[model samples]
Target chain A: MVASFGPVALAVAIATVFGLLPLFLSGIIVPKKPDSVKNATYECGVETIGPTYIQFRTPYYLYALLFVIFDVEAVFLFPWAVAYRQLGLFALAEVAIFIGLLLVGYAYAWRKKAFEWT
Target chain B: MSFLSCPFPALVCNPFGLARDGIYGLLAAIVPEPLPTVALTVLGIAMLIAIIALTVMSQVWVERRAVAFLQERLGPNRVGPAGVLQSVADVLKLLLKEDLIPFKADRATFVVAPLVVLVPSLSVWSLIPWGPGLAIADVNVGILLVLAIGSFTTLGILAAGWASANKYSLLGGMRVAAQLISYEVPLVVSALVPVLWAGTASLQGIIESQATVWNVFVLPVGPIAFLVFLIAGIAEVNRSPFDLPEAESEIVAGFHTEYSGMRFALFFLAEYSNSLAIGALAAVLFLGGWQGPILPPYVWLFFKAYAVFLILVWIRGTLPRLRYDQLMHFGWKVALPISLVTLGATAVLVSAVQGTAA
Candidate 1:
């Protein structure tokens, strides 16, 4: 078992070294030529505008929260998919219960104007 | 019986074979018994590496051609006949291109992001069963494993965006994270219908059960689950309509804006490979993966996966991307409710049928 892990460990080490070595090499070899124009935010070469970092709307975060809930729900599907055959009718019934709950959540989100395009 | 005609007859005299045996003997000297398992482990790793690399490369070419055809144009025909060598040419270009990292970027995380994208993408394949008796592991929680590993890709995308220190990249990453997370709910709920029917999370078990009748035909809710899986998959891979993160017109390549050359290619490779991975998962979950007459199992697996990929490419070419709000709305309000209801109904019907069967 120890021997079995040797190659995998080696592969990971090699991959990590290759992935990171280039960054250090480039930093050392490449000339540092910083200028105001070079550091400017990219927006098709217009003059300096207002502050680039502004607080974004809270709606985006709400969307993200909703996303987390749904994503967790999606994660449950994989196991369900794998075990679909054996679960048979009883299993299906259980899923129906799960889905019913999810639907309620969905309906709640919908009525709250979550889908409205602003 | 026919020693002269038999291939590899020289195996009787092969020194390398002897040397290999000698090495095994030496290892045996250190630890007794189970010599073959060590050799098998090495072979398995090699096979996995080769399979993942080959799949990623071939799928890239397939996607380009499929997208081109959908758009009514020839894609990469100049590189090789029917663009067969397009991916190969791309590999060379990526190899030759100078890898550039922005000075302002988070050095460690930016570099780590691509690895994050790739490793999880490849790892998910460990659970997929291409054919009967063909898989890396036949775990009972194979479905859960896939879901768990697949979600890591979103983290990788976010890491890329945040590490880049570019506003567009940050916006793109945030959008992708949100989209993937939201759509994941319906996708999972819908997927549960199949699990409820199958009763085991082993992929091989799913295929074996479906051998007689595919779930698509058996359950009305199965198709609904399939649709949810497809849409969620598209979002997961950031392909077309849901590809808000890499919206070239607006975000200037999104999370990967500051990346160049090989580093950028890593993201590209991950994108194409993830597309294939998700497509394959969809096939396995809903389309009866490698479940067909006559052809070999792996061939059927590829055919189904490629078919899904073609559909993705078609959508990419045919549809316009949804705005951020519209994207969120559709997932939360539309797909989520429909899928949830579908799951509930499937469960009720399945139980009633079981009552009858019992």
Candidate 2:
């Protein structure tokens, strides 16, 4: 396990450098003369709106809530899969039950149109 | 025959591996333990990152020209022999542009968001099995680790959107968060099927298990799982027809709307890198990583990965962008269910087959 993570540590360190190097270089090399007109929040061609922070009736939250639940359930399948060959039929049935139980919630979500973008 | 001629059987595919061993051999001969190993690992990862950059640049050039060909237009033929140096030129210009942070944007978060987006995407490559025994880390829980790391991009994107303090960016961020999370379910579920099929979480083991046949050829379940993974992957990277997040027509560039210069370039880098990563992961899982005849294993991996990516480029060129509502419905209602069922069925069938064989 320790051996496996060696590359991960190295890669993270390298990628961090890769990610930051350009920004660091650009900060020094790039021209920066910030003016209010230039730096104003992009609004295409429109002038200053009523309030920049507009309240949105995002229908995505329902989907996000469902995602939180189902995504966790999906995570649970990983260990079960890795150890599957030895699990035999009994564990298969148990997993079927497990997935079946989750599908109930999925079906309920579907019935309630939790997925729909209303 | 190949092994007889070359002592290192996988030398063609495993350059980093060879380099690591060679580094350790020379350094160990000269110095001592642990330090040489550390130095070798650092060098390997640095090389890996450099190669990823080269691949991403090539992918950028290939995509523009390929998509243009799809539309019967001559694309980027000017710069250095069929526009091969176009990405290089674009990078140079982006680096010199005025770095601007929007007046209302959260200064620190805005600056950090691109790095947050970029690091995880690059890190995913370390665990990818390019050829047999070619991965930097053959972690036991490779698939799970990959999914975990890949999910962090959503966080970075949300930060970019929220930090920008712009209405369109905020809306785009929220929409993207939902899209990514919803698509992730199918992606994870389908990814795990190959693990269950191979009976190991090690990506190299999974690839070796597919030497005789690829996972996509498995009857009943393989094609469904591959289809689900592909669609979710396209959504995962915000590619069309599911690219509603950054739909230029609707959102004016989505979460990165307020970003400019190197910051904006970082986001583009992350996006393209993630797309290429998705292509690679798909090649590894479904099409069989580094498993082919004649060509070297690493070369096969690259061909398969680029082939998958070019298919996506074709998709981007051919298909119209999806409406946000349609994308959400497709992810949650359509893809999620299909993948879930397919995974369950795959588990059952694979176990049954193994049981009988035993």
Candidate 3:
């Protein structure tokens, strides 16, 4: 039964090698002849312009922040769900309260248009 | 042969189990103390990798042929009798191409990014229950483990995009992160339907609970949960029209734009493998993993998975990609609220039924 850990550990270890194998093999098998022109940042053969990193719009960050709230809500719900059968009606009442609190936050977000992409 | 004694539905008439036990007993005796376990582990892991690698190769071929057929093209029929060897040929070609590193790119991170993306995608396949006693491991937290490992793909995409130092790659990476995180809400919430109904998170246990009726047919919210899981699963894996992260026309291959040779191939393989993994998870969770009256359990599982994949391909062939804003809107506004309500309703209904019965 200890062998059960075998696939899991082996997978973790093998994942690195799996990722690295092609890179390593390509390093050995493939021919590399690099020049400045070939290695330049690809911009349709035009001269590279400003810095590659640009400031993204604020909407992305807003979306991510909202996602974090829902994600945590999901995590909290999991334990409640797994033990829901044993928890009885008291548990249902607690969940109703929990969801109400989360809904308050959700309603606020909706009213504020945080869900809007623009 | 003692290991064969484990009570499992499949083992009752399983020829594979009988044959596998003979090898297990022989393997157990052939090695010295403490070494046998390690040897078997190596053998098991190696076989798993081999199976997955072969599946990935064939999957690439199937996608090409299926998509081509959908588009009324003949597709690759020259290589190895009906293009069966096309993926193998493609692999050779990929291996021989120059490994390109973009100017000003972060070398170490760029080199490692594809691996990071691919490793998690492959590792997620380990916990899938192909049949009774046929999974790699049935960890109690198997479903949670899958959801957690799945999120790692987004991180890997972010790393690839940032390390490339390309504007397109950065956009792709950010989009992947946003999209994946948003979709994870629905995925996890819908998945909880199965977990809650089955009263266990173990993949096999969920399937066992569905022995009489699969979750998709089991009442008020089962179909709703399955549909939510399906949509979220598709978005989770970055398929069209949800594939804004790597939208080809807009971003020129997105986060992987700067990658060439095997590195790009790794990302490609990871994408398809992730698709397959999500399909298989859907099969296990809703359609009843490896459960059927005719054929074998694993066969049923594969049939359902490939059916899911075919639907993905059909969607790809028919639908136009959504805009970035539209993608985010769908995830946040549409998917999130519906999943939350469904979860609440399911909880209430389940409690009502169970409360009365008790």
Q: What is the lDDT of candidate 3?
A: 0.82
Colliding residue pairs in candidate 2? none
Compared with the true structure, the alpha-carbon lDDT of candidate 2 equals 0.84
The global C-alpha lDDT for each of the candidates, from Candidate 1 onward, is 0.69, 0.84, 0.82
The weakest ten consecutive residues by lDDT in model 2 chain B span: B1-10
iRMS of each prediction: 5.1, 1.9, 2.1
Q: What would the per-residue lDDT of candidate 3 be over residues B1-358, giving only the tens digit for each residue?
A: 2322234454553545665667678877877656655555555555666677788898888888888998999888889999999999999999999999977899999988888898888888778877777776678768888898888989889999999888888989988988898899889999998888877888888888888788888787889889889999999989987989889898888899888899989998888888888889999889988888656667778788878887888888888999887877787788777887787777777776665223
Comparing 2 with 3 on DockQ, the higher-scoring candidate is 2
Docking class of 3: medium
DockQ (C-alpha based) per candidate is 0.32, 0.72, 0.63
Over B1-358, each residue of candidate 1 has an lDDT whose tens digit, in order, gives: 1211213333332323455566777777777666554564444445655566777788778777777787887877877787788888886666665555565667899878987886666656656776654565566766766777778888989999888777888888887787787776766676676676666666666666576667766667777778887897888789999999999998888888877656776788678767887778877777777777655566778788878887888888899998887788778767877876776666566566643232
Give the runs in model 2 whose Cα sits over 4 Å from its true position: B1-10, B16-19, B29-31, B356-358
List where candidate 1 sits over 4 angstroms from the true fold: A1-53, A70-108, B1-39, B356-358
Q: What is the lDDT for B111 in model 1?
A: 79
Q: What is the TM-score of chain A in candidate 3?
A: 0.84
Using lDDT as the measure, the top candidate is 2
- Residue B321 of candidate 2: its Cα lDDT? 92
